[model samples]
Every structure is written in structure tokens, then in C-alpha cells.
Target: MPFSHAFHPATDHTRLGKLFYDAVEPASFPAHILRYRNNRAAATVGMDTLTDEEWIDHFGRFTPLPGSLPHPLALRYHGHQFRQYNPDLGDGRGFLFAQLRDDKGRLLDLGTKGSGRTPWSRGGDGRLTLKGGVREILAASMLEALGVETSRALSLIETGENLERHDEPSPTRSAVLVRLSHSHIRIGTFQRLAANAETDAIGQLVAYVLETYYPQLGVPAEGEAALTLFKAVCQNVARVGAQWMAAGFVHGVLNTDNIAITGESFDYGPWRFLPRFDQNFTAAYFDQTGLYSYGRQPGALLWNLARLAECLLEFCSHEALTGALSDFPELYETALDAAWCRRLGVMQENPEADRAFRHAVTLFMETSGIPFHCLPFDWYGGGISAQRALASDRAHFYNDPSFSDARKALEARRPLPGLSLDHPYFAGGVPCNMLITTVEDLWTSLNDRNDWQALDRKLAEIDLMADALGTRESLSD
Candidate 1:
């Protein structure tokens, strides 16, 4: 229920497996522990799809995935809280509980973010707030649905403990966020080894990442083989960045420690998906400088990769490392082009068509901003019929003079990249649902005070349209 899709739990995740129930309650990050009722996602992960009674059974329970003991692991090192060399931060509030392959063979980490203190917690309570968990779950699910490559939120439980931070008005409660990631290794994993002059461990970590995450890299485990691993990580990282951009998702925090070697979306702290296109948009309250805004994410990813590349240089030559980074722009553009093509249902690169789609998107945002900017996203998504019909309603756009840009953007014909008569992603496309008014009330509803839930509930009713829309894979090129 807390995740994007449901399946029976595979087996207890076995990687560097550690079990918990006797949490130390680091008491510094005092988490407001909340137990998630995991009937849906837990089952999918091959765990005991819990019954209410079973849920209580699992909590404070640390049974390792079958046939495994506490798997050994060391946190990779790096700078943090901005550029400070904090070589001591590793699973501060949480630990990697288990790692398992999903039915798709994608490895997902069943790690807890606010589980409790680890050796590196720095005298801080490892507790998470209930509110913190809630926000992360929402952010993860919504992003996944929108086709962004992100770590999944398995289950979240409020720890029921109260937390007080300088930012909260009242005491906050913590929640246990069961994070599903491709790998638990972070950039810090590499940095820490580099810091300690443990080149051996650094190589070991690189080998582990390659064997577990990218055996396809076709490189050996030692020597320049490490450079090859770096190249693969760069590709994955760059593709993820493009996904975030094409979908308007902002991770908010891009600390080196959060950069998984697998380049999957790992930490979900202070993240948000922008409802409106604003390059300067930021989700974290403390991110005053907008360091992790929508537009800046790609640069941040590249910056983190640079850090990783530097760390790897201890083993590989700079010439090789620098060469690896060169692959970034091409990889990122390819991902963006693919995503953009999918959205438009076209694959051939047609500059004119792309320009038109971009224009339409720009105009849709301008018009949509006048009303219902955040809630329903029918204009960008929904059925084409509904979307095209709503465009005729001048009242929505006319209210804001700037909204006219949308009209011009749409009217101008540019060869659209995905405008092919048969792109599967848009094969049976229908218009989006922007208004709740009975088929006849689009004009009035545009002017009415936006009622979000009215649209949200209606969405449930319209899911049938998805079936009517037919199989999406059929649109695949």
C-alpha cells in the first residue's frame, strides 16, 4: 500500500544483512517510530505480508533474510552538511536491513532511515518524525507513477516518539521509512575508503558495486577496471538526472553520502515534484540558496559524480577518469530525448515537433497557473480529447494575460518529435481531466475556487479510462 506496486515479498534481503528490533533509540535523532501496516508492499517484497497481529510480530524483530546473518558492511566516507569532511557519517539514523532482487531482478534495499543510531550518528538520536516519513512516502510514490526513476518507499511507521527540532512549532514524531534502493552504497562509501587511505577497501567497494549493480560493465575488478565502473556509475547517474528533469522531480538534497554507486534515487529527504515549471523551485525549507532546485539537479549530479570520480582516481589514472566523465552529456541527452519521445509518442528527432511540444508545455503551465496549479494535472497528462477540449475555454487562460503565451505556443507548428501517427505511449491518448464539472461545466469550473479532492476522487472513477486507453506497452517502439 505504501509503494508503487505490490508483490509478495521475495526473501529476507540478504546483502550486508542486519536485523533490528532492539533499536538503541540513539535518542539524538529521536525518531517518532510509526509501524506501517504492510499488507500490500510487504507482500511484494517477499516478506510476511503482515496481518495486524503479524505487524506487531515484525516490529522490534530483526530476522535476517533467510540463510543470512548480520551481513558485514562499512559506510563509505565523504564530506557532508555542505563541504565539511565528515568522514564519520554512515547510516546515522538507519542501517541497511536487507537487499533483495525484486521479480524484475532489480535489487531493492529494505533499509530504514530513522531506525536508530549507528556508530556514526554523532551522539544524535536516530529517530525520524512522523511528518518526515509521510512526506517522503508521498514524494516517492508520486514520482514513481510519473515515470521518474526513484527508490521506492516500502513501508513507513510512525515511531510514536516525540521529537523537537528548532524548526518545528510543536514536538515532532518520527517514522520508520523502509527505503527501497538499488544499492545501499553511497559516494561516502568510496570517499571514506579514500580518506582512510584504504585503497584496498576502495577497490573492494568498487568491485562489489560492479558485481552487484553493473556486472555488465565488462570490466575486471581491479586496476583500470575501477575506471570502467566509474563510467557505468556515471551513465546510470546521468540517466537518472535526465529522468528527474523530464518529469520535474527535485531531490532537494544531493549530498555525496546520498549518491548511490548504482546511481538510483536513494535518500528521500525534503524532496518534492514541482507542480509548475520553475527552474528555481526548491522543496527543502533550509535550502535557502535554492542549491537543489529543479534546474540545478543535473549540475549537482555531475558535481557529485566529480567527487566520485576524484575518489576513484586513487586507483585509476586521471586520464581514464576524465574520459569517463566525458560520457555524461551524451548519456543525459539520450535519456531526455527518449523520455520526451515517449511522452509525445514519437521517436524520430524532429526539431519542429519538439519545439511545438515545448511550446504547448510552456503554454499549459501559463494557463494552468491561473487556477488549479497544484492539484489536478489534466492538462499535461490526462486524455488528449479532454485536454484539447479544455483548451477552447478561453476563460481559464484569459484571466492571466501571460497565459496567452500558451496559446501562441500551441498554435505555432513545429515538427513535433513524438507527433507520429502511431507512438505507442500515446496510441489511445485521451484528454486530461482538469475540471470536475459534469461534461458540460468546464468553463464555469475554471473560474470556481479550485476544489482538489473533488478532482482526486474523480480520478479514482476515471482509472477505468486507463483500461479503456489499453495496454501502454503496445505503444512501445
Candidate 2:
């Protein structure tokens, strides 16, 4: 009841009509134990002041937020799973619970994962393992700190239930996760409309997206609107793809349904950070072919964008769509340059110099066998960190012949002005890394001893890293 003045709630998605989603009820859990609550994210939507009891009533029991959605909506969508078209795919375990404007006036959705089964629940129980919830929190936190546009794990509550899962040890603890993201619309949302030949619905969806998310484009003439939206989404997908690469993140599942139409990364399932710069690194155990491997992520994004472009064919010219799709490589390259510069804490030079420097760094990362995070961590602030890098425990890795070109390239670039290299985080022997081993260890402590201290400590370290990199505040800006 203590909503802040900044609170602005809207049920905009409902305007799309019953055809877009099915209103559903949340499952009644036996118990509600608050596991994690992101006050920083909750503050954005003016719900930070809520007591833990109120938080449970709202997020856990699905008691509707005032002036927001009355009940959850299981959104309908279709997507390609590993290049195979699956018409049955939709929000089986999750639903859009609420929509409200953040402090910056951007629309944010409070979506639930593992709240309960929906109409799309194909047969399996729609529950999420507690371990799965923890993994998502870790992935989202780390990606945000690394400057990736990602969803925030707003609330994670351990529901009093034991669920059986084949992937993990059976009879795992159950939890429901609330993710805060800019939009829940996915590329597959369009795909579903197109597949059904619902051209009128597609037009309405395009109008809604442009008006709500891409207002900068304004109301273009009907003929040009679809193409303009396609172009903008293309640019967004390209930039996010490049950001993922620079962050050394492998999203594991790059399915079209998992890709947000707003370009923000959400649905952190089976995601992993690179331990080393191996192109073949993959996150999912079931990803036997590595279709969504680290190196293939950009191509996967482009492929999904093309699928989106196909959905617009009924409204836009084929030639124009193809031309827009072709621009991804260049847009991605430009974005990568900017992302790498930001991560390394350097000012970008001329395009040629930036390209050469990136190439040199890539060559060294691939051949020198140094840990992927070390490159940016050691060379952060560019030439200014030379002494600090040289004295680090991993200095011998940098002395390898393969690193000479990258070392020279880094020294030639200037650090961004006003970077606070004196931060205590940088004084450590190594940077904050979220390797698989580290994640598993954190989970082990929690699953065995119910000890949250390890996870809490890691979150603190991630916050410190974000502060040092200036990513946390910059993302809100």
C-alpha cells in the first residue's frame, strides 16, 4: 500500500485483446519463504518499501499489484527450437504478472517463472527447481555487472514443494522467480501471428510496439512503419549480440522465443560465462551439437532476426527487409568496438586502429590460452594498468609470445579519463568471475546446508565489480 509517487502502473498488454494471451491463476504454494529480493530493482517500480510479508503476498501469492494486471496472463507465442519450427511453444511455466513504469518512465514487466502451469503446459508440471532459480539470479547479476542489457531477477521465493527434474537430481526444491525486464514480447510473438496469417493482428502488434517501445521512430506512414520497426529491432539484436560477446557470455539457448523484441536479454536458462576464449565453449549439457556455442551466437541472432523479418513480409518490401538484415554485420562490428572499449576502460580510437586492436586481442585470447576474463581485467584502464597487470599472479601468461601484439595494441590506446582504478576490487589477485565451477560451488553450499552466505557474498562482489566498472548506474541511465 506504500506505493511511491514514482509508481505508474498500466495493463498495456491487455489492450492487445484475449487473442494474445490467456488469463490464468497462480498456483497456491504450501509455504512462502523469501529467498532473494532485489530492492534496487523493486525501487525502480516504487515497490521497494514493501515489508517482506507484503512482498510475499504480492510476488509469491500473486496478489495483484494496485492498478496493474488483475491476474497473470500466459502469453501465446511460437518459436524455432534449434532451427526446428515448434508451433506448440508458449509460456508453459510463466506468465506476465504485472506491468509498471520505472523511475525513468520505461515500461517494466514483473513476469513470473515457475509460478504454475498454464494453458501451454504441454504435460509436465510447470515448476522451476530452486537451483534453476539461483542460476538465473547469478547469470542476470553477472551479466548486468558486465554491462550486458539483461533482465534483473527481482524476487526469488522458495515455494514449499519438491519437483522432479531429469536434468538435476530428482526431487529438487521448487521456487518461483520474478524477472524485471523492459518487454516480454519476443521475436516469436511475431512469428506466431505470421504463421496463422493474422496480418491484421500483426499490424496492430507493430503499432503497439512502435508506440510503446520505439516512440523515437514515431508514427511513420503505414507502408514504412513495418520496415522501420524491422530495422530498429535489427540494430538492437546486433548490439546485444556484440555486448554478449564482449562480456564473454554464452546464452546457451539462443532460441527465437528467448530473444526479446526489445533487444534486452531475458530468460537466463542454462547460460554460462567463458572460462577461457575457446570458441567451442557451450553452456547446456543437452546442446550436443553446440548450435548455440559462444562463437556462433552472432550468427544465431542474425538467423532469428531473419525469421522476424519474414514475419514482416506481408507489410514490408522484401528487398528492403533483406537490405536491413544485411546491415547486421557492420552494426555488430561497431557495437563490438564500443563494448570492448567500455569493458577495457579505454577510449576508442579510429575504426582501423580499433579493429586492429580487437583482432590482436582476439588472436592472443585464442592462442595464448589465458583465461578470457583476465584480458579485460588485467588491461582495464588500458596502458595505465601495465604495471598492475605485470605484477599480477597471471603475469607469466601475458609474457607468452602470442600476447606481444595484443600487449602493444593495448599500450597504444588511452584509458578513459576519470576511471577509479584504486577501487578495492581491482586490488584483488583476480577479478570477479562467474565460471561454472564457481556457480556450482555456490549452489552446493546452498543446496546442502541451506547457507545463503556464499551467494550473498558473491552478489556483494558483483555489486562492487559493477560499481568499479560504472555499469550499474550507466545501465539505468
Candidate 3:
């Protein structure tokens, strides 16, 4: 690889000793068949020079890349799983494999899932099903296309193994997956240190987070560092929650361990795109209580931020911590307005007007029975093309009187400057969404006949949509 040494695997965790992580090795597999690779994400890290063989060796066989970690580290952390504090929680099937800098000079981590078992493996095998890998690829791709900050699956390898599972069919295929993200440090990391009353360790971790992940925050005055970090984290988490809500995404599980410190969405286990504007839509079959439902996501995230604040109480005054927590709702509302405006393809000139237009759009979608994901696909590029949207097969029920006010309000807002109303994405009628049924159908084609045409086409379509919307580019430009 051209930038092999672009990786600098330094284990600061070793300084924290066995309290934060366990040394582990990857599981040996029968075969290493490449199933997927994300070249776009690779380009960001200058890893595009890796040959197919080397990619397999480093990512599939789990060999430590040169100048990277000598051994995998299974991070230790206790988290609130489904609101129940579980002290035994940590990385069981996954471990931090390597660390590298990206094109922007930001540090990134390469983490593995289904690598093998560590001390935290509890009772189950530390492996991932092939279907799970496929689902994650789709979820990450779609989320990225929708302009959400999310972890990308760098590589997925079908490790030759016949795995038996209860949720999925018995004797399903197995796989190993590698993910690339800004940071793997989670909210639960602080929770664990706080739980052990390791105030010094928490302070050290806080400094590390500032330097490595939240560098823009700079070094705060000594006494106020923890409070400043908490406020910044709260704002980021609020922004993420807003993004998920605006995108109509349900994360399935909102465990503290699943909440990354950098606020990037990852660990897509049972995620789902909304089929309608139902507030109670849940992705996980076991979430019968609707705890992490679509409407409750913002609430769940705010709750997690409060927990993170609790972890910082020892370093900061109680008043400061509570003050930071108090900002979540307002920050989330502001973030939601901005996110909704971006999705609707309009200029956010007036905050009141933006809010009114967004509310009207929501009412229209709810009354017209349109799927929430259709908002961007239909209104993308900034103008309401009711006729064009109505032409789509999915828009058969979009003729309700409730849309009158929304349509008029939408007409009043200007399209984002320079974006064509007739962009290819908008012209295509409806945008593609990875709803559960669609995902299952794509997987069925692969599992039944080893066909990948549908998946390939869908990815291409998503890429085109991203280009049309300038998803990765600055919207202000």
C-alpha cells in the first residue's frame, strides 16, 4: 500500500493497564472470501493502494498492519443495556484492530466485528452472521448517502463457517467485518471509569478525548475542562439524534455502549427505515415496549447524554454538569430544524418560516400516507415538484388535501442556490430506501442463488443520489 505507514498504532490503553481493555487475537477462519469493500472510505485514509490479497491478509486474516497495533485490544466498558446497568458489558466479538490518520489529518480507528472471543465474550460465540454483515453494509451506505455521520464498513469477508442462529435461519453463513470510523471511544468508556471511582483515570481519559477526538475544543482552563467536554459532547450527540430523526432512522438499540463519543452512528444491528410516519416504529423484534422507537430516539440519546454527564460529575461541579445537560433539548430542536431544511432542499433564511414549512411537510406526509424516507427523494434539489412526485408509483396516495398548505409553504422557500430542480435524483421519481422488506428481498436474491446484481445496482443508485445531492460536499457551497 502507498500509505502503509499512514497507520500509527499506539496503544494508550496499555498505560491505563488491564482496567480498560484486554489483549486478544483474531479467530482463524477456514476461508477468506471477499464479499465487499468500500473504496470511497478507503480513499479518505489513503488505503486505496492495498491489493486484494493484502486487504485479505490485513483485514480478513486480521494481521496487524505494519506500524499498527501489534495485537488487538478488546476495550472494556460497562453500559446501560435497555436501561439496565450491566457491569459485565464490553467488547465481546469485536476489538480495536488499528489506528490511522485520514486525508484531513483526523485520526481514525479500524475496528473488527466477529473477530473472535475475548474475556468479555460472556457465553456466546464471538462471530457475526453473513446476513448481519450484508445488512450493515446496506445500512452504512444508505446512512452516508443521507448525509449522516456514520461508520463505514471498510471490508466484509465471508469466513467459511456454517453458523447456527436463533433469530436467523439455522446453519447460516458467517463473516468477519471491519469498520472505519472517526473514533471507537464510547460514552460507556467513561461510565466504566466512573463506576470504578477512578477519578484520575477519568480525568486522563478526558484529556485524551480532547486531544484525539475533540481537538477543536482545545485545552480548556484546568478547572473547567470536564464541563466543557461534556457540553461539546452533548451538542454533538444532540446533532446526531436530530440527524437520525430527520432521516426517519430507528437505531433499534440505544445502549450507552452503542453511543460513540464522536457522535457517529455505528453498530447497525436491527436498524430500519420508516415505512410510514409512525412514531412507534421499531426495528428490533424484541423491542416490544417501543423503548427505542422512532419518536423516542431523541429522548433516548438525551438520556444517554445525562448518563455521560453523571460520569463527569466527579471532575466538574454538579451545577456545571446539570447546566450542560439542560442544553440538550434546545440544541436538538435547533439541529432538527437545520437537518430538516437540508433534507427538504431549501434555504434556511428565516428560522420561523423554516419551522413552519417543516411542520407542514410533516403533516402532509402523515396525512398523505407517504413513507418518511420519500421526503428527500421527492423534494431533493430544493423545489416541490408535486406533479413529478405524483408520477411515481409510490406516490399513489399523495393526493390528500392536507398537502395544500405544505405545498404552498414549500413554494415560498427558495431552493438551495445553484442546485437544479430537475436534478437526476429528483427526476427519477422516488429515491431508494433500505426498508426491512427491501433488504430481505435483496438478501434473498443473494442467499437463494448467489446473485449480487440487485445489491450492486442499488449501491450504484445510492452513489448517484449522493452525487446529485452533494452529500459529501458542503451544502453551503
The candidate maximizing lDDT is 2
Residue-level lDDT of model 2, residues 1-477, one tens digit each, is 577777899899999998899999999999899999999888888989999999999989999999999989999999999999999988999999999999878888999999999999999688988999999999999999999999999999999999988888988899999999999999999999999999999999999999999988878985898998999998998888988999999999999999998999999889999988888999899999999999999999999999999999989889999999999999999999888888898899888888888888878888877889998999998788899999998899787776788889899888887797899889885899999999999999999999998889999999999989999877878
Clashes of 1: 59
Candidate 2: C-alpha RMSD after superposition: 0.9
Between candidates 2 and 3, the TM-score winner: 2
Which structure is stronger by TM-score: 1 or 3? 3
Candidate 3, position 394, lDDT: 55
Local accuracy by lDDT, each model: 0.57, 0.91, 0.83
Which residue segments of model 1 deviate by more than 4 Å? 1-40, 71-76, 219-223, 343-477
Tens-digit lDDT string for candidate 1 (1-477): 422243334323233223211223322222223344334345545554444444432333434444332432224345555545676677677776655666556556667777676666788777676656655655554445445566767766555566787765447555666776667777876776677777776666766677677866666744667887888888888877876775567788888888877777757776765656677889688888988888788778888888888888778888888877887877776676555434432333465555555555544654466332221222323233234435444345534566455444333433333333233323334333322133224212322533334433433333333333221223211
Please give the lDDT score for candidate 3: 0.83
Ranking by lDDT: 2, 3, 1
The candidate, 2 or 3, that scores higher on lDDT is 2
Best by TM-score: 2
lDDT of 3 by residue, 1-477 (tens): 445444444454455566678889899999999988888788777677788888899999987877767889999998999999998988899999988777677778899999988899998699999999999999888888787888998999999999989998989999999999888889999999999999998998888888788888887997888888888888888988888888888999999999998888999999999998888899899998999999899999989988998998888888888887888898998888888888777788777777787788887777676777886666554445656666777555555566678767776777777777566766666677788899999999988988877778888988887777676776212
Cα-based lDDT at residue 134, candidate 3: 92
How well does candidate 3 match the true structure in TM-score terms? 0.96
Q: How far is 211's C-alpha from truth in model 2 (Å)?
A: 0.5
TM-score per candidate:
0.74, 0.99, 0.96
